[model samples]
Target: MTAADDSPVHQGRRAALVRQLRARGIANEAVLTALGLVPRHLFFDSGLLPQAYQDKAFPIGAGQTISQPYTVAYQSALLAPQPGDRVLEIGTGSGYQACVLVALGAEVHTIELEPSLSARAGRLLARLGASATLYVGDGSVGLPTVAPFSGILVTAGARRVPPALLRQLAVGGRLVVPVGPADGIQRMLRIERESATAFRQETFADFRFVPLRGAEAVAPAPSQSGAETIRSAES
Candidate 1:
């Protein structure tokens, strides 16, 4: 089905999913509204249409899965994008998350490591008129040419926070990523760039995501700077 095929059943399902997200502690009304507007079923294959709004991750080919709705809502809530905010999404799987970001009125630049996924997502986003710029590249390094984003979100699990991404954040920008061993549960972290050389980090609930692919996936040397402060928070 195409993005234009949003019938009553699909609308009902989407609304239900939004309600579920709110009940699960996604307090960002704008994020929830964006989720309510985007048609999730259109991002799925015809065979998986029935499971589209179930708040579960399903394979989207290329060894990736469109993240579960709750995960998307949670991460988006943490990012707290304001209209016109420039945001970079590290993974473009299914382009669903990008669509959600666009619905929130953010300027989204999403990168995917897999060419096939990028192409498919590009076509779908274009058809939906989501207006997100899709790039096929090593997302771990981020899009340096478009540095200084108001927000950067990494959809995959990495060994540690990528320093390159931190460098790309605009002062006061936030980067939300899941960090831990690739094979185990990852702790969701929100790192905020406090100034030119200072950052503050806060940890959230644990989630399991596909391992991030690219050169920086191997654990990188820890940041040598002492200006960064880390704070842990339980969900």
Candidate 2:
């Protein structure tokens, strides 16, 4: 469906999903609430809707998958989003995560390395009535013009947290990423920028994701933002 059903049945499913996240150690009320409100089924094809609220990842094309619901809630809780935070998300994916960020009251700036996905996500977010600036480029390099963001979230697995993303964080800001070998499982990392040149990192649960790609991954910058290159399907 072009929009979430948002009917009683769908809303009940979302509520149950929130309960699942809570039992699984997602303690942030705001994160849980956001996850509960965004209808994950709307991010999937009609055939995949049956699996949308089950807390599992599902492919969304472009060789990418929308992250599992638990993973989304975990990352959102770890990011410790505050209202009005200027958050930079390194991978837009299906825009599900960005929608969560929006629901939590963050001012989001998201970048996707894949043009098609970026455009699709932008339109999806718009249709969901969420506001987030969407960019298509080297997510590994981050959005420099929006440097010093209050928080950052990276959805893909990286060999190492990109230095550029770390540099973009405001002092006292946090950057959550998944880091490890491309063919192996990745550790979810929370890095807090304590000062101009100092940061602290902590490792959380292991997860798997598509390998992040682009200039920081040894590729060139995308020539155009997906916004400039693709006509959003919903539009």
- For residues 56-155, what per-residue lDDT tens digits would candidate 2 score against the true structure? 9999998999999999998999998899999999999999999999999999999988899998898888888899999988888999998889999999
Question: Which ranges of candidate 2 are over 4 A from the true structure?
Answer: 1-4, 218-235
lDDT by residue (110-161, candidate 1, tens digit) is 9999999999999999888899999999999999999889999999999988
Model 2 has an lDDT value of 0.87
Q: How accurate is candidate 1 locally (lDDT)?
A: 0.91
Point to the candidate with the largest TM-score.
1
TM value for model 1:
0.94
RMSD of each: 2.2, 9.2
Q: Estimate each model's TM-score.
A: 0.94, 0.90
Q: Give the poorly placed runs of model 1, Cα more than 4 Å off.
A: 1-4, 223-235
